[model samples]
Target: MGLVNKTRITDNLAVIIGNQHIDVIATEDFPFDVQIRFIKTDDAQLDDGSGKKVFTPEYQMAFAAAYKGKSAFFSNTEDIKSFTKQLKEIKELFEFATLNKQTWFDTASFDGVLSQKVGSL
Candidate 1:
């Protein structure tokens, strides 16, 4: 339903999830597509027509808050616990490249690894 694992660009202008780059267009006046992706199997920033998905401004704003350390990034204590669980389950994922948003695994493999331990997340 949502971007399960999203990376917040430092500028907060965008958030990338699994090869897709989602820009923040909080208002209708802003002229731009909200979602951009390479392909279902590649994160090279190429154009893909079928990779489209629905976008919601509210959800994007919530994800942008994650870039602000002072923001209530975690809704409650349980949110922290869920994050902690993810850390323990996959420590290697914390190390990510800053050049551009990327996923270490393909959809199926990534989902398989995380879903196996997503009891609380």
Candidate 2:
């Protein structure tokens, strides 16, 4: 599974992960150094037959702006647009980390030769 581009419809943003839809919300202070939260829409189970619903923690991304050698804030439309650009990069990093973790586990028990082969590929 991979992170898909967020679709904007009106005032809300939708991020697709696997078959799930996650909503992104801005913090109370919108036009400033703010944090964005990713909320999962479904309560899916993480364990098989455990009956325990998967608890997806809120994922947040923050951005701070600086101007004239001091801390600046988002004050215009451009600032909000820049924040969205940063959000895209953050999502990519999140997906990369997930993929790396999976690859690490898949090769963790490999023998030395196999490990080297996989590393070189």
Candidate 3:
């Protein structure tokens, strides 16, 4: 969720994905428009009565790290592959919990992701 600052009047809205706050930087208002579109689709299912809904923070952070670290090159492919595999394991755990009607520890938080991935082992 990157938002380019348009005018001084527009309040920047963003998703706190992890340690970093992603903001869009563009020359014009088009950045805001693009962000809005992402919000519409991304936040669609995250609607509770209070309007706060669950989001996959773990997924977001993982992606953030992957992109920021740029771990897809030959030199970093192993790291990327390892991280992806960890996420896949978490996905499996999430699916199993859902299937069994078992409570899943929150996977939408940074701590939750770390705990499930690192603490479990």
Taking the tens digit of each residue's C-alpha lDDT, what string does model 3 give over 1-121? 2432222212322222222222222223221121210111122245567876555334121111113332334457786685566445434433433342212122112232211322110
lDDT of 1 by residue, 58-91 (tens): 1011111122233436789997885565333222
Ten residues in sequence with the least summed lDDT for candidate 3: 32-41
Which has the better TM-score: candidate 2, or candidate 3? 2
Model 1 has an lDDT value of 0.31
> Which candidate ranks first by lDDT, i.e. highest?
2
lDDT of 2 by residue, 24-63 (tens): 3333433323222222223334655677545432222222
Return whichever of 1 and 2 wins on lDDT: 2
Q: By TM-score, how accurate is candidate 2?
A: 0.27
Off by over 4 Å in 3: 1-75, 102-121
If candidate 2 were superposed on the true structure by all CA atoms, what would the RMSD be?
Answer: 16.2
Q: Which sections of candidate 2 miss by over 4 Å?
A: 1-72, 104-121
Q: Evaluate residue 95 in candidate 3 and report its C-alpha lDDT on the 0 to 100 scale.
A: 44
List per-prediction Cα lDDT, in the order shown: 0.31, 0.35, 0.29
The lDDT-based order of candidates, best leading, equals 2, 1, 3
How does each model score on TM-score?
0.24, 0.27, 0.24
